[model samples]
Target: MPDDVSTAGRPHIDIASVQRLAELADYVVPFAIRAICTLGVADHLVDGPLPIPDLAKRSNAEPQALLRVLRALAGKGIFTETEPGVFGLTPLAQPLRSDHPVSLREAYPLLVGDLQAWARFDYTLRTGRSSFEYVHGMGYWEYMVEHPEESKRFDGSQAAGTRVEVRTVLSAYDSWAGLNSVVDVGGGNGMFLIGLLSRLRHMRGTLFDQPHVVANAHGLLREAGLTDRCTVVGGSFFDDDVPSGADAYLLKRVLWSWADDRAHLLLSRVREAMREDSRLLIHEPVSFPGDSDEVGKAYDLILLTMGGGCARTEEELHALLGGAGFRISRVIPTPMFPLVEAVPAT
Candidate 1:
């Protein structure tokens, strides 16, 4: 017997049909969140509770429709309605604020914004191809390159995510004490490298990514007063021309964006660029034996649907590294992701 049923004298869900019927509409939450985010609901509620009519006026949405959305969200604990007509932000809704220090509003684009591609998720399962391509008529990176406006949003989302993740990773792992020069592979906008370099003031760094990505990094590096300590390089890792002479190469939240073969190829290229004593640090989510699949599984689905990648288990990653002419040194766990350290095998 299941734990819930065993604890109870009788089964609350004796009929599977009734249970499935009650849970069928669970997919509505993401779209509901996207709808509220699109309307900038959390930002408008900064001061205090507002009546439905007033909130609707600010959002320029239909009063009745906005009221319905407010009511629905309140049930989901995203908002709370006082008395009859006034609605205010719930504790759960605080992270949605655009100005919040640890705001998740930036993540709304990739999470809730890409549901149109996810709507065709079954197509990916059927053909082993990207559903994002099926919907957008191009691969993820190609689409981003062609559309600068959308690409900007996507870049902002990544940098925001890197902020939270870098904090988590730094707290768990030791500082790069012995490593002199570090290169952040596929480093987008130099945000993560900037955070790490700021802490390790003595260490110099390099941010490597595409030309368009590196073009924006110089200004941010200058703004952060890090241009003197960090160099920005523009190129693809696949070409095997990683910026030379760095003792450490870091791939933070990057490897999950490629298929196994491409991941191996990229890692091999990095390996080719490394000296015998150098290290490669891969920071991303991963699975381990007998562990709960909650985080890894959700991320794998997103990769499969949009990014043409997958999160691997420790054993799987071990093989990937070994195949790429490297060996795993250790795996360090963090709140958001793990740090898989590898050294050259040959």
Candidate 2:
């Protein structure tokens, strides 16, 4: 009889059980971290290290419960206990601070907090429909349009992720050098446009998005000192036309929000407005045909849950663009996102 197997006087353990336990344990960590971020623990610790009781008082949370949460996070190296009963920030936790330019505080809550539509994610897995649609009885975009506060949180979360990638795209693509004007199609909150226009002083930009989304962009453009170089336009991409006479048009993290049919519609609209020589840049995660990378796979699920879309392989993108009258001209790699430059085939 094997020592690992159960006899009348012994017990058995399986490796599968260990794997399952680790997976379940991993699930609890995100929710716990979300609670701390939502309670502003990182923000409270911004000035200096504090004891658990002080943190509890400032956050209006019970000392004992908050201590347990912090202790768990410390185990994960998010924070450290430098002295008995006192906590301090760790390098990993710095990004959680609200004042950080690329803070993950908003992203944390958006991904795990009370407003997370994925709490009912089982509904999505079972029905093969979007969790946002299943839980809210509407699509993510429709839900955002209906709830202004939630929309703001969603936008802030997106902006945080975009800030990291915007600079990478700007530096990687050489197409911006001689362009006189650029139009950002479906540009949310205008972060990409702001980054691009800020870099190229002589270039002008037009930001096009839904009416409510574009409303938020106006203030951002002004804050970026780009008011003189940018224009904000509001309309649906499905029904309305894109701005004409731009030398470059960009769709950053945009097309993956819809299925192929709708994506084709959007590309068609951009093609109609583009001059024969205009450049079209599509920035997104280029999923390889067989490789399984974490962000690419997780984003695949996020797309399915938030909307009925999927990330595409390079070949898939070529087909998608070709079907809509555009052809791939070059593939530019950045540290974060890939830039696919296309042009009108005819």
Candidate 3:
């Protein structure tokens, strides 16, 4: 078939190319969803459908504007328009609910928070510096630290995300069930340890992160009935000590936020916390040739824009781990990133 073929005496057309272009340029749907999530629109409609005026008032949004956004999202099957001016929840919109069993309400906004950074992606492409810093006048971590409320929300979103990723990590690694104890370095709010210790009844764990981050871990661990089995410690992974002598030390979804030097320093910190027999388990997406992981690719750019980081390949990981004085014992592949296990070199 020709790239463009005439039909009914009209000019040649390429529907596939047109579709690809439209897909690339489409941003309205995502932005609309982000707006709704940010405004707590879905949470307000939990009781039942609400007229646009009531919904808007509840969400502190303009009635007409909220109606228009809902109408647009309804067409995309996000929310439902039972009748004109009345909006209700749909199956697709359930996760947007803050009270839902699985909530992504916080993640969406945090993902798209720096729209200005994304708009200036060319700056990252040209200079290899963080567009987030360029746009916000500070790096992502500094901004988070300066803004306590936003930092808390970011921690919420990360803990929520860890809930979903925990399944992947657990199912992909059978050795977790066998471990007697594990330490979750940089573990936010102890979600991962909660899930792990809940299943492996005999296992004890420790959750380590910054002071502000681990402050919530105590209550959460208590609520999960894991307080007795898990210890919470507060410190930076770069300059502070991690809990040592656990059967395994976990670095999950954490290192990708930093460039190689910081990442190496973090790994070395964890290295100092490990015994010779202790396993260092790193859970993150690793790049490789012929890889078509769009999520990983998108994250590579997200990391670049936010923090001047990029997804590393297995070889890059090997070098980093080696520099941190560990040897890769095995690399276990998973549906997402492979779990790279290492042990102390000497």
Candidate 2 global TM-score: 0.84
Each model's lDDT comes to 0.83, 0.83, 0.84
- Let me know the TM-score candidate 1 reaches against the reference structure: 0.84
lDDT of 3 at 336: 59
Clashing pairs in 1: none
Q: Which stretches of candidate 3 lie over 4 Å from their true place?
A: 1-13, 47-54, 110-113, 236-241, 275-277, 323-337, 343-346
Q: Tell me the TM-score of each prediction against the true structure.
A: 0.84, 0.84, 0.83
lDDT tens digits, residue span 1-346, model 1: 7644646576656577676776664766666776777678889999999999999999888999888888888987998998698999989998788887667777766443366788888898999888898898888878777878778777767766877876777788784788788999999788889998887887899999989868989999999999899998899999749987688999987787777899999998898778899999999878666656456667777788886677888999999899999999988887777888999885
Displacement of residue 86 (Cα, Å) in model 2 is 1.6
Off by over 4 Å in 1: 1-25, 110-113, 145-149, 177-180, 275-277, 288-291
**Worst lDDT window (10 residues) for model 2?**
108-117
Q: List the residue pairs that clash in candidate 2.
A: none
Which pairs of residues collide in candidate 3? none
